[model samples]
Target: MPRASRLAVISAATLLVAGLTACSTPAPSAQAEADGDWTPITIEHALGTTTIETKPERVATVNWANHEVPLALGVVPVGMAAANFGDDDSDGLLPWVKEKLDELDAETPVLFDETDGIDFEAVADTQPDVILAAYSGLTQEDYDTLSEIAPVVAYKETAWGTPWREMIELNSEAIGLADEGDALIAELEDEIAATAAKYPSIAGKTAMFLTHVDTADLSEVSFYTTHDTRTMFFEDLGLEFPASIAEASDSTDKFSLTQSAEQADAFGDVDIIVTYGGDDLVAALTADPLLSQMPAVASGSIVNLPGTSPLGTAANPTPLSISWVLDDYASLISQAADKAE
Candidate 1:
């Protein structure tokens, strides 16, 4: 989901936009790790073996993994970095995340302005014991820099290494909540099944997933046909993918990228449209003849995502926004799918 969007990247200028259904701390409490464990768990990062110092105190998280586990485990990190960047026009994880932290009366961590590049000096000053870099791209330079601050746990196989589930396990283990982490995953699985059961019609339905590119032709379009982050969200509601989308993905060696409206329209029957936005999209549709003609649009079934804000990420899969998001979007998803009729 962190794929580079060709659409002009949000400059270092903005604020944010923003989870998931299941919120849990994993197995293995930090107390367990602290007991008889001087275990040398090496995270193969660009900088090489990042050994954990059992029972991390001051922690810093950058990407999704950074945001999720830290919060779920009841650790108010000393420093934080958002999963992505956008303007305050859409709430980023900050507001929602802050709410949870506030509920616990935990001290809020310092958030990195990702647009301006990660601030190593600020992180170094925190003197963190363990660093959760799971959802981050540990560039050679960044890695070198972060290692100086603390032992960094980067992705194992790829940049944002490992599946989301694995990420939970590993990050949880790192924090010594392995048991809690496993249970959290279980609860999430059950919730997903129940969610899917609620929208029986969404199953087998086709959907077109895209984010606003620019003022022009809606910029970049990402069409998901199968296993991916957005898929879970749609599947939870029993939503289906259009035939055209299935075909485009069929031609891809990896994930397919949509470049134009023609490619976007490939899923002609894409009855539902879910994307990141504020009113730019709603306004755009009303202003743009082409977009206004989308079958989903003509049928009045489009759901313009709440743009970037502190809690907007709730529509996505993350630890913080999951609980509140469902309550927020339930009406929208049900109505959108119902309108496809």
Candidate 2:
């Protein structure tokens, strides 16, 4: 079952070469390490500080799009978490990830199925030199278990709250490609800016992403709080968080929070709403007296993304998926923004 929090659903991919000029350059740190000289690098994170004593050759990534960091920097993981949501195909790989593998002319690596939980035995069998989960929600126990397998890079701050830039920076640096990671960040920033520029309507609009709304249960509302990467991506797309969301998020470290539907008026300031569902979900929202009274719902300023499609994963930007999904995602948001009252 798909977790209610977008943070729980993992996604990945690689960017097109034409759009990634930075990827063409050889990373200086990687080149130096290739010559048998590796400088020790220590990283501080919410879990604990991890030090990389030597260059890692067999990199493995657990949880979410951590694999995209290495794949974006021209390093394929020996193993990584299999796609659990928005896969589109039953191959356990998202489309962009599959495309990256094909572009690299390499076969699929060992995919650790994470439906139940972290498959420690499967991750151990990969024999990874390091495990990356800079954007994951790994618990202390998961971290300790994985640490026994290899050096682990967990989230820097709140779990699943690591922005795309930091995710790339931390993961790439771990693999001795810090410079390349910086380049990747610059390229993506430019990409986001350029795409956002095309949808001026979405610019400055206050937006909020609703989690999987139970159309059957209209008594409560669940949403991604500011700590979530999906909410963070709003800024990347030139969207502002409604003051209500910011205020609600200010008090909690949790990535998601629920409020009674009777209090749905709190989101009146939101100009556009994005959520994972279909037409029926939208109808349900508009039909509800409390929800329909909200400006966005009454004005039809909502983006109901199909949860099962590759496009459904667009809200949570990653190194690779941004280039692939930004245009369509922005267009949807822009259209919704135009309807804002």
Candidate 3:
């Protein structure tokens, strides 16, 4: 049986694209080699100082959230944890990332599947100089174990709960890619801006980052506030939030909004709602009593996300998915406008 989070509403084509992006080649860069100088560097982490040896060439990453950071900085991992959600054997590499790698002609690296659990022996077998566990639910036990094999970069804070920007910056510095990370983010922002501009209808509209909650309770809902699910992925588009949501958020999280039935409807007045959740959640919405009556759904102004299983935690937090959100959601919004045309 597929995991609850495995349910999705994206098209097959999108899934294929997302999968391809996950395994795509790394950008044009010279292969990293042992530079001899091992310096202790103190880098900011979700927890605290993640002191590790400098310029680790053969790195292994457990979590996929920071996968793009290294790629963005041209530091392809010698190995990455297996794709847990997206492509089973491939690890959670999204097709967008794969495509970008292909664009750069980067080689695909070996992947470690952490689904069963992290394989300490297997990871050590990769002979990785440094290990990155950024954006993961790694326990202290796991941290201790992995550190024995190589310096581990586990969550400094809650798994994906950390800021995407900070994740990018932190991972960049950790992998010696801070400058490139900034450049990648800048380019990504430019891409978001261009795409947001292309979709004139969504501009200045209040949009609620959505997730199809389990249809059990019509009132049971969740949303992406500021610090929620990288919903700020649209900030570059200059998208605005509705007064109701803005009031509710009051500067809470950046990624998601968990609200009641009344709170779900608060997004009713949102100009265009493009939710990011699984098919299970969508199923709940379609069958939901009160949810069906919400203004956005009733008016057909809601654009259900078009990404595959990748849109869940793993997909939303990565750099490539940030762009994928715009592509997937922007197209949906544009199509909505076209249908009216």
Q: What are the root-mean-square deviations of the candidates from the true structure over C-alphas?
A: 9.6, 8.9, 10.4
Candidate 1 per-residue lDDT over residues 236-263, each given as its tens digit: 5567666676666576634336566544
Candidate 3 has a TM-score of 0.73
Which candidate leads in TM-score? 2
Model 2 shows how many backbone clashes? 0
**Ranking of models by lDDT:** 2, 3, 1
Candidate 3 stretches with Cα past 4 Å from truth are 1-39, 88-93, 100-107, 216-219, 250-258, 262-265, 276-289, 306-317, 322-325, 334-341
Question: Which model, 2 or 3, shows the larger lDDT?
Answer: 2
Could you tell me every candidate's TM-score relative to the true structure?
A: 0.74, 0.89, 0.73
**Candidate 2 residues 1-341, lDDT tens each?**
43333212221101221124245445877667564877888998899989987688889999999999999877889999999999877898888898898899888999999998887767766767789999998999788767766789999988778999999999999999999999999999998999999999988999998986999998998999988888999999999999999999999989899999999999989999999999999999999999999899999999989988889886788988999999999999999998983
lDDT of 3 by residue, 1-341 (tens): 24222222112333453456457525434222344444566766554456765477777777655677777666777777656566533534567667767767977777666767776656665666677766776877677666656677766566666556667776776776677888887887788778878888766666666665555655677776765544665555566767777777786644555677755555666666666654665566666777766666655565665444554433265776777666666777665444333
Q: Give the RMSD in angstroms, all C-alphas superposed, for model 1.
A: 9.6
Query: Relative to the unseen true structure, what is the C-alpha lDDT of residue 252 in candidate 3, on a scale of 0 to 100?
Result: 64
Assess the local accuracy of residue 298 in candidate 1 as a C-alpha lDDT between 0 and 100.
Answer: 72
